[model samples]
Target: MPSLSTALARALTVTAATVALAGVTALPGAPPAAAAPLPPGVVQLGDGEPCPPATLCLYRDYGFSGPAYGIGAGYAIDLRWLPMPGHGGPTAADNVSSWVNRTAGVALLIDEQGGRTRPLFPGQHLEEPVPLNDTVDRVVW
Candidate 1:
C-alpha cells in the first residue's frame, strides 16, 4: 500500500498541475509560501556561486552559501546515502537548507519522513524553506 505521504503527494501534484494549467499560479494577495510557482522564468537570484545548467543544487546554508550537493537533471536521489557537507550531520537526509533548481522541469522535494511536500520549479528557490528546512530526504526530478 502507498504511504500517507504518497497519497497526499499524488493529490497535491494533480491539483498543482491543474492550477498551473489554468494559469492560476496564485490567488489574490496570497503569500509567497502558499504558492509554488511565482511566474514563468521567475528565478531565485541570491548569493553563492551559480548552479550549473541542467542540475539541481541543494545547499546546506541559507543565501546559497555552503557546501552543495547537486544532482543532475533527470534523476531521483535519496539523501540518506549521501553525507552532509561540513558543519552538518552525517547525511544530507535532513541537513539541506536551500536549493537552486536549474533542471528543465520542476523538482519534487520529499521530506525525510517520506513525504513529498512540494515542487520547486525550474529556476525557483527559497533561501530558507521555513517549513521544509532540514527535512528533505529525496529529490525527485
Candidate 2:
C-alpha cells in the first residue's frame, strides 16, 4: 500500500489530469512559470563540483508546524531525493554541500495545479537523527 502522502499525491495528480483534459487554457503572451528562487544558499544541480553518483541528496526541513488537516501539521522542510554523479563515490561532506547548496532553504518541488514552486523556510541537517545505512529515490537531477 502507498503511504498516506503518496496516495494523496496520486489522487491530486489524477484530479489535475482530469481538469487538463477538459481544455483549460493559459493567458496569451505569458512565459512559462519558473521554480521559486532558491533561498540564499541553495545551489542548482550540476553546478560547481559535482556530487558522486550512487549517493543521494536529501533535503530536510528545519522547523515549522501548525494545526492543519491531513499529514498532521508539522513544519517540515520538504525532503527531496536527488541523485549524485559517480565515477568514484563522493565523500559524505561533498554530498551534503552539494545538496545544501541546492536546497538548504526550500520546499519540495511542486509541478501541478497551474504549476508553481512553493518556497519554504529552510532545511537543516538532522544531526541528532544521525546517519544510517538507508537509501532513497530521486525526483529531480
Which candidate number would show the highest lDDT if scored against the true structure? 1
Q: Looking at model 1, which ten-residue stretch has the lowest summed lDDT?
A: 37-46
Which lDDT tens digits does candidate 1 get at residues 1-141? 999999987977777667767867653444333434322222232336678788788777887776666677767877765655454476667888888888888888887574556788998877654765788887776
Residue 42 alpha-carbon offset, candidate 2, angstroms: 1.9
TM-scores of the candidates in the order shown: 0.60, 0.20
* Candidate 2, superposed: residue stretches over 4 Å from native: 1-29, 47-49, 52-77, 80-141
RMSD of each: 17.6, 18.6
lDDT of candidate 2 over 23-129, digit per residue (tens): 43222333433343442323333333332232223322112111101111122322231223332122111122122212433333232322434232233222112
Against the reference, the lDDT scores of all candidates come to 0.70, 0.29
Inter-residue clash pairs, candidate 1: none
TM-score of 1: 0.60
